[model samples]
Target: MPRAPNEKAETAKQMYLEGQKMVDIAAALDIPEGTIRSWKNRYKWNATLQKDNRNVAKKCGAPVGNKNAAGGPPGNKKAEKFGFFSKYLPPETKEIFDAVQDADPIDLLWHQIQIQYAAIVRAQRIMYVEDQEDSTKVTSMESAGSEAYMVQMAWDKQASFLQAQSRAMKTLQGLFKQYDELLKSDLATEEQKARIDRLRAEIAKVEAENKERAGGEQPGDDGFLEALNGSAVEDWADED
Candidate 1:
């Protein structure tokens, strides 16, 4: 049998339709803001709200042949663009488009930075190797009564982790470069620039400490693996 819908979710949907912000709805209903956001995304609340608005506008639309109410208000093409997208795109994609339509480029890049940084930090714990003896064995294939297992030795796993970390750090560095370029533009706020600068300083400090530990010599490939194993990376992870 199909499960019943959540009562709070229904109430939240009604509040959303009535033009309440998600945070406000969460506060009023004593729900977590994350839950409210999840419900909004899962239920296509923005699309529903837009559909309702269109319905109301259709009902109260200007009289036929009235030249005064023409061309969708001055310089406003959002309705037409949104209509096109709504007709052609899936609800989830449309929601993402609407969400990021007016977002600042620098802010968008910062969000990517946060996501990439968090992923890199998370990989450390997932791919950690205690010593040379530590290894992982997984069943690679199974058919009928026969099975094939793949054993990843400690050094092999560590090498794989290092390579993956290298690629991730390269992507992260590229993001930082893009962010720096964006910050050079007038559109970026002082706060946005400062945050990137601070993060860069923190990363550089960690890298320097790692180099110092390795006989004060700068290693090639940006010392990413060295920084990855350092304790300071955990502190950086906490910032996210």
Candidate 2:
């Protein structure tokens, strides 16, 4: 006699199709293994799951019968964890973000600067598209003028963003200069300062000596000495 369609069998079939072994599924679901095995055989669960797996792999362009090394299938947990945002961002922005993601003061400053810069670029693109875009083809001349005004307003916003960005950079420069002065005030001892001054003096002396030597010699002096010494050595060799 055919058992009526029921919840237990349906549950058993679902667990078996999910790649769980019959014994484990039976243990976890508190059902007998023989009953689950019966459900598996009756529902043709293995064949159905195999077909589904092959279909999934084909859709993802993965070779048949090969499990992914990173895990099973594309868009698996690991790949998303590693680079979920990589393809969505512009290459240069992605590169800048990646390079500065964990870096220090420069990263913070770069982040501050790029926020305004990105806003300016977005505003410019909007303005460009608006200017070139035909306004529904049925727009009145006044509407066209209004659209032009809107684009010009967006362009004005972009200019404001750029000027703000420049002011931010200059402010950041001053802040950094103050920071450097603070670090120097706390960290530099008199001895280190004296040594630094002495090193600078020595570098200046060496640079001056090099400059003097470079211009002091006549252009042909080295060649003339070489020729004069060459004949003297030959005469000495002939005497020997």
Candidate 3:
């Protein structure tokens, strides 16, 4: 006796809801992905389209946050500051992020960079406080000359660190650009590839529009600095 047609369909529907891919569901049920996809289209088996609803995708289809590192600290706050970008990532990519979770190398590196930036901030704050303390002490000193010398040295070091940070950020941005290109070139899903291309074209269009807007007069140093300071990059994640 053969199984009823609806019985098999029920099994497929259950598997699909359990987060099985169309291909895997098909294989498990001795059907093709196309056939499974057809059933999916007709019945809406994989109906959850919202990224927040799905498990993060991994190449190996593993569970999320199963890293080898021992749990110690609760979280990295500086990285938490860039949460806005995570919200905007394509649903599929976020699924991938969810899939890898704490095990993803890129995620770890991004957190490391955040820690580094926090350290830089701390150093800058300490330098400022030290200079203030020195100034207060200088008021009682017989020599006003030594006060200026020490302050100058502190300012020089602060300037150097700020310059290094600016350079490092530029380098990181370049690396992210390359990483996005490589993802499109080597690892991007069909949907991801098409979307990235579209975004690139849009960015080009925006840049051209900006140039036109600044016609006859290029943005001055102040305007450029203002633009930089106001950029949405401040809110975006270090993912790229």
Alpha-carbon shift of residue 175 in model 3 (angstroms): 3.9
**TM-score of each model, in listed order:** 0.54, 0.24, 0.25
Candidate 2, superposed: residue stretches over 4 Å from native: 1-4, 61-240
Candidate 2 has its poorest 10 consecutive residues by lDDT at 220-229
Against the unseen true structure, what C-alpha lDDT does each candidate score? 0.73, 0.50, 0.49
Better of 1 and 2 by lDDT: 1
Candidate 3 structure quality by residue, lDDT tens digits, 14-95: 7666555665565445577788778778876656543425544423544587663544367753222223333355547755
Name the weakest run of 10 consecutive residues (lDDT summed) in model 3: 220-229
Full candidate order by lDDT, most accurate first: 1, 2, 3
For residues 1-240, could you state the per-residue lDDT of candidate 2 as single tens digits? 997888878876776676556665665455787988887887888898999989887785757776665465754543232234443555567566667655655335434534643453354344332322323333334663474323335445444444443443344345434434533655445653354345335535544564578775332122212211222223322322
Instruction: Please list all clashing residue pairs in model 1, or write none if there are none.
Output: none
- What's the lDDT for residue 124 in model 3? 42
Clashes of 3: 6
Which pairs clash in model 2?
none
lDDT of 3 at 123: 48
